[model samples]
Target: MRKAIVRVADLRQQVYDNLKERITRGEFPMDHKFQEISLAEELGVSRTPVREALALLVRDRILVQAVRGFRFPEFGPEEIVEITEIRLRLEPYAVRLAVEVLSAEKRTALAGLIRGEIARHGEADTWVAAHRRVRAALFAPVRNKRLIEAIAHYEDTIHFMRVNTLQDARWRGLSVGGSAKLADAIEAGDAGAAEAAQATLLGLARDSFLAWSAENA
Candidate 1:
């Protein structure tokens, strides 16, 4: 019975990952309602797993309860600003911790990842993946598991908004440049410069989101 329960839990996690990937890729329209029956049918799964996955996503703030079911929450300027504030506080501290603990080899590896992403300018998905690797490198040395988990959770929650913002070529270019600068600072073991680079990156992102929101509003 324990083995059977473990298999079911694993299946539910798989469903959750698949749905999260779809949402991140913008396959589902923002604010579109989700139906557990339809999703289960599409994925060739049962409603129990789909229902459980949806509940997990709702807890992650990636999905919210709607009148009928769940919908992806639309982020506005204010929401973006709030996310930015949290990122600015949390990320720079992470960078500082990273600089203190990262070995020279790890720094070199991080630089390589940043350069690779910079070379792949127009491919949003690849760039985002590489960017994530860079972040993981920085956070790898942090001893506090809970802080690292919080950072990862925040990143997942804002995944869609970040991807949508990168859809703008100009913003994408600026983002790559910021990453390059950040990588350089980290490689040099300059904590202050790394923190500054993180601030610049988040500041540009915050400004871009606010501008887009104002224009749309």
Candidate 2:
């Protein structure tokens, strides 16, 4: 079946989404230079909406404004490590809560995501996809909009670090054991164990990011 063509408004949203994804994924790289007119031209859009999108990104702390133009923000090792620490504290609670409220189907899906992680070990794209899947599972039960927004904000920061650190071989294997451990805990229906496993997983991820931060520093 052929896919429907995207409308102009949808295309604008897509452009903004693509730009955000690239920036967060490090496709644009830290401190990569970009301009309103040029980026709009490249994305086949008007400068007005591109400017609007960029303005929102700057508000989101995903981009920084320079004297010349806009660039991806450069974070220090300390900043990234602290963000990981936040994830360590909050994300486990999210998963534990999810296990209580998640449907049988979602539980199955979460387990499947863990299996995917095991299967995709060492593949570059697998790392990101696996992380995303786990996060969706964790938050699937959450209904609080404000809390969700806050977590999403934190995730943006985390995604930035993940993308930045992906080039390191050490970071590649950091979550391998942790993923399986958390999945086991969740499958066993042990909330405390799930939280503990999630914490351990978060610590492993934190340590990896710290190592990357040190190297980059």
Candidate 3:
């Protein structure tokens, strides 16, 4: 019975992870209506696990239950701004916490992320990918698993929008400078400066996104 239970739990997690990745990569469009039966058929799995995984995504606010099936939720300006607001609150605190534990080796690695970003500035797609790497490096020093999880949850909500922001040359420049400033603060072990750097960049991103939302709306 225990072995059977483990298999079921593992299957559910696999399905959940798979669906999240597919959604993130735009395989599942916001207008794409899908149900457990179809997903199970496509994934060659039982509907039970698919249903459970869909429920989990719904609980995470990453998916919406439609009348006929499930679909990715479309974010409006308010929803997008709110997602950044949550991050703005949680991430700086995460950074401050990280300062207490950031090791010399980790600081070196994080500084390397800025240089990598500089080297790839000419590529649009790489800027997005590199920014993601910078985020992962910045958060690596935080020892609180739950805080890290919270930040990651909010980050996932705006992954595509972050990519969009980095698509612009001006935004990309600001972000590269921000990464350098962040590395300096972290290397100096200045928690206050680190927190300020995080908040300032995020504030700029939030403002930039809002402006884009208005123009594109």
Residue range 119-162, candidate 1, lDDT tens digits: 87435645655565667776888898888888888787877756
Question: What global local distance difference test value does model 1 have?
Answer: 0.80
**Which of candidates 2 and 3 is the stronger one according to lDDT?**
3
Model 3, residue 214: displacement in angstroms? 2.2
TM-score, candidate number 2: 0.83
Model 1, stretches more than 4 Å misplaced? 1-9, 122-126
Which residue pairs does candidate 3 place in steric collision?
Answer: none
- Candidate 2's residue-wise lDDT over 1-217, tens digit each? 9999875455556666888877665566565787988998898888887887887788888777888779767766677668877777777787778777776677777777776766875456557655766666667677766666777888775666666555455665666667777777777777788888888877776677677667766
What TM-score would each prediction reach against the true structure? 0.87, 0.83, 0.81
Candidate 3 TM-score to native: 0.81
| Cand. 3 Cα-lDDT | 0.78
Model 3, position 92: C-alpha lDDT score: 92
Which candidate order results from sorting by lDDT in descending order?
Answer: 1, 3, 2
lDDT of 1 at 155: 81
For candidate 2, the lDDT comes to 0.72
Q: Model 3: how far is 83 from its true place, Å?
A: 3.3
Highest-TM-score candidate: 1
Compose the digit string of candidate 3's lDDT tens values, residues 1-217: 3555343348899999998876654454446787998899999999998999999989988888999888767678788778878988999998888876777777666666667776776346567767776777778878889999998898776655665576778777777788778878887788899899999888878877777667777
